[model samples]
Each structure stands twice: as C-alpha cells, then as structure tokens.
Target: MSATRVLTLNVWGRGSAWRRRLPLIRDGLVRIAPDLVGLQEVWRKRSGCQAERIADGLGYHVTYGAASSRRGCATQGNALLTREPVARYDVLPLPVPDGVEPRSVLRAEVGATTVLVTHLTWEWEHASVRHQQVRFLADLTHLAERRGGRDVVLLADLNAAPDTDEIRWLTGRMADAWVSAGSGPGHTYTPANGFARKAREPARRIDFVLSAGPRAVHAELAFTTPVRARRRTAWPSDHFGVVCDLTSDPGAP
Candidate 1:
C-alpha cells in the first residue's frame, strides 16, 4: 500500500485581500498535512519568494515555474511542495490566445511518482488555446512513458468543466481523479460574493486532479477549512481547494 495524500490549491496572487487570507491558507495546510501540495497563481517578490514561505511554514521543499516574466521580475506560475526529495524539476509553457493571460505547467519528481501542476487559461472564447493546452497535457503521458516514469498526476485549475470538450480531450488519455474515486461532481469555484445574490453565477468545474497509471482511492471536495466561504469572507480565491488520495503502484516506493 504505497500511497500518498496530495492537495491542490489555487492561491490567487498577492494583493490586499490575498494577504489577509494567508492565515486561512496556512491553517488549511496544517490540517491536511498532505505529502505534496500543488499551488497556482503564486507570486515571488523581487527580493523574496512565496513558495519558500509556504515551504517554511509547512516544513516541505518547494519547486515552481514562472508564467509571467518582465525584465528580471517574474510571477510564479505553479508550485509543488513535497516531503520527499525532489529528483528533478521542469516547466512547460502552454499556448495562450491573444488577449489572454499567460499559463504554464510545473513538473516535479517525488520519490517514484511525477507530479505536474498548471493553471489553464479562463477564456471561453479561445478554443484554440484550450485545444493546445489539452494536447500538451495528453502529450505528457507519452513523455512519462519515454522517461520510464510509471505514474503521473496533473493537478490544476483548468477553467473548464467535466463535460467540456477540453476536459474530454485530456481525460481520453488520463483518468479523472474525482471520477475514479467516485466523488460526485465536486464544484471547485464558488461565487466570490454571496452565493445567490452575486452578480456572476458559477457555471464551470475549473479545477481538477487527473491521474495516470494509478487509481485514486479517495477524493473529496475540500470545504471543511475556514478558507471555505464564511459569513465574514467570501473565500481566498474564486476557486476552492481539491484533495485527492492516490494509491500508487504496490511495487512503488
């Protein structure tokens, strides 16, 4: 029973509101005590690092990639935190349509498993960008095979739902972790304002945990933490965190 608990969270960038949510995020991480943590929309200061802060607080090593860069300043794209030593790290930039924000995939090797984290574009009108992103992810399965990696898990805010074409494309080659574990239609993103009276209605299942070469033994929508919308605060991000428990190969260490 070689298995590890993994948690994915999209911490919207550093700003006034996001700063205030740090305690809530830290508390959530403390509660889960996951073996690995995948974070999206993280930012590193010109003189400091955001992932390092989280790693220090949680007692884990961190690896990340940049999605936006200007001169020497870079905005962190996706990050992976692991209790196990990181064997290697790489970043793959995904195609973004014009007028759309940048996106990238961050990959790290933990023990015998390789984890990839990403933040996909949110533009509904840019079908080409979605197509390219899905294609790139599907290609990762092949990449893993060539590298002799037996398992790959991708966690991210895809900005598309289960029924969407992009998701179908990606799932054609990889297993959806939630579906594999029998977690029913978990909604990751909730309206930032009041759930009902909010001007914008939540319509999509943007966040996900997709796995290959292994089965998800347990999965659930992470709503137990105070980060989940309370009466006082809407939420840390417009998206909710997703937790997946993966059962690795019995032979894997």
Candidate 2:
C-alpha cells in the first residue's frame, strides 16, 4: 500500500446558482490535487455534467450514480473524481424510506484503495432513514473488504451531528479521518446565520472522509482546510469542503 489523498463535499447541486459556483468548485478541487474526490448532489444534463466538467478541468477519472432521471433527458446524482483511472466499480441504489428521494453509493477502486462515495438522507424528519443508511454503509465497507480490497474509505454527506447515533455508529466502525488528522471541530455545516442561530443550535460536522484498512492508514494533520468561496453573491456550496492526505499502512492486507 502507498499514499492516497481523498476529499468529499456536497457540490450544492443545480438547485441554485450552480453555474456561477462551478469555477470555484473546480479551482478549489484542483488546488488540493487529491488522488480522489467524492461529491454529493452532482447534476447531469443532456449536453454535459458537473463531474465531467470538473474531471475535464482536473484530469481525473469520473464515475457517477444517478438517483433519478427527469423526463429522460436530465439526471442528478453522486459522483467520484479520481486522478487515476477507475477500472472496477459499481453504482448501488441505497435502501430508502417509503416516500423520499432515492439515494445511492458509488464504489470504485483507484489503484489499491477502495473508495465508497455517497450522500445520506437530509433533514431531521429523515433521521431514522440516516440511521438505516449508516448501518448499510457499515455493511457495504465490510463487503468491500471481503471482496479482496484492503484499504477502504467512505466519503459522504451524512447530515448528522457528531454525537448522534448515526455518527457514533459510523465512527465506531470506521476511523473518522479528522479525528487523527484534523484540527478544530471540523464543522462542515453551519446555520445560515451562525451567530443568530447559536442559541438554538451550534454548527455541526456532517461531511466526512472515513477510512478503514486491515492495517493503519497514516493521515497527516498538516492541513484539512475548508475551501470557502470569497464571492458575495455565490459561494462554493452551502456546506464547506474538506481536504486531507492519507497514506496506506505498509502492512495493510
């Protein structure tokens, strides 16, 4: 096993000014130069798509899982952009609640590491759904290991706080990349007006890059800077992005 750098973020989708922030997203990702990146809320249109656009700019391999298709001409989903070509991979539709937007996971291998990219149910109303999704994610990671891969990572936007059952369950099973190699609370989600909302709720860290291997994954706490757009009218996304560097343990199976 060697070294790997992974990043994950919710790209804010096309629901808003996706076009305006596209350059910021591309520049931010290119600046980090991660080996692989996982993005939630990526969109696809007839002419092109977000992942493909960024992949083209950064020269990274692109893989996506469309959760739904609109009128047969448009699509929206999660995506994986890797510096190395992804040869083996699959898109899995995750188990969802009775009536909610369908979700999915993209599993791919870049070189020797298996990366699982996904976005879970959002909002308090879907907490139980998130719980189920977390358990399923745990099962999926283990499944990847059983399939002959040693280094496995989960990049996602879970929409849950750190102490909640969902986060506890996930960090309990997989190593939270930030725990070993991050500074501060690493808050990825914040209220629209953080100062005004603190009385009700503080910021939360929901986005993550969790990794598990038969052996240790050395992560340097050098810097996991959150990329924030400086523009007033538009920002990179509603949530912040995390950038971290990880090296696979030599003894990894």
TM-score of each: 0.88, 0.86
As for candidate 1, its clashing pairs are none
The TM-score obtained by model 2 is 0.86
**Model 2 segments beyond 4 Å from truth?**
192-202, 214-231, 250-253
Residue-wise C-alpha lDDT for candidate 1, range 144-164, written one tens digit per residue: 857886588888888888888
Q: Rate the local accuracy (lDDT) of all candidates.
A: 0.76, 0.76
Top candidate when judged by TM-score against the true structure? 1
lDDT of 2 by residue, 50-155 (tens): 8898678568879988876776878778899887789788888887977788888888877667889998888787778898888988998888788876678888
**For model 2, what is the alpha-carbon lDDT of residue 126?**
78
Error of 2 at 55 (Å): 2.2
